[model samples]
Target: MLNSVNRKVFLLYPNLIGYARAALLLLSVFAFHVGLLRFAVGSYAVSQLLDAVDGEVARRLGQCSEFGAALDMIIDRVSTIALYFAIAAKSARAGLLIFLLLLGDVGGHWLFMYTELKLGESHHKNSAHLPPGLKHPTSEAMHQKLMIGGNP
Candidate 1:
């Protein structure tokens, strides 16, 4: 009989996927700097797709961790901010909207996450601390709807 044990490493599969996504993000930034706009946009697009893949991989491999989740969230915020900044740089007229969008998207999400932490609830789940008159929908589903403008 042979016995096998699973040993977790700092560079787990899901985390590796995250690292790759981060690399792609960096590549996109470099491409943009070098005026390769098409390549930059394409790389950024792939990196966004990898973000979802990492979460799915974590779930399937039972490798989810607090560090991974937090890292993912941080990366998401940074990427969003960077993208918005790039868009805003194109014209002054669009800058105001980008600023408002950044405030709403980044600031709002941070506040929501902070509230969930303080209330001792999983950030994605409904909990007793939910504000009055608000329906208790899972954060995951709400996020999906908000992101894609459709049902999760």
Candidate 2:
């Protein structure tokens, strides 16, 4: 087996998927730019689905790496921001709300990742510093609060 440090993680299946996601997002943005709404939505949706698969593929193939994690997050943030900006262009009033939400999304991710690096964490998802109840998004309490029709 190859040592972790020497592995060609960029070529790993998960990272390959990440690259594909980046390409798809690029296409998505271009499509949106040219007003090809169907193509934009289709590429973006497929990219999002691939994002869900990459991490699981990484775990199953023993290919998870910090680089892949960062790539995934970067692509995800870009996708979200691009979509938000497109939507924000519709109306000034609602655009402000969308922009604020986009700000929170980007700011929160940056803060979380920055803190992780500052604290020398091995994984971006490390939330041990948080209380047990809030350590995970899938936790029962969070699920109930976040699920559709559950609560605001």
RMSD of each: 6.1, 5.2
Q: What tens-digit string does per-residue lDDT give for candidate 2 at 1-152?
A: 67876578778999999999889989998998898999998998788777766766787788878889888888888888887887876566787789788889999988988998888876654466766554534223334433421111
Best by lDDT: 2
Quote the positional error of residue 146 for candidate 1 in Å.
Answer: 14
Judged by lDDT against the true structure, how good is candidate 1?
Answer: 0.72
lDDT of 1 by residue, 32-125 (tens): 8789999999998888877766776777788877667777777787788878877876666898899899899888877877887887875433
Clashes of each: 0, 0
The TM-score of candidate 1 is 0.74
Which ten residues in a row are the worst by lDDT in model 1?
A: 1-10
lDDT for residue 59 in candidate 1, whole number 0-100: 72
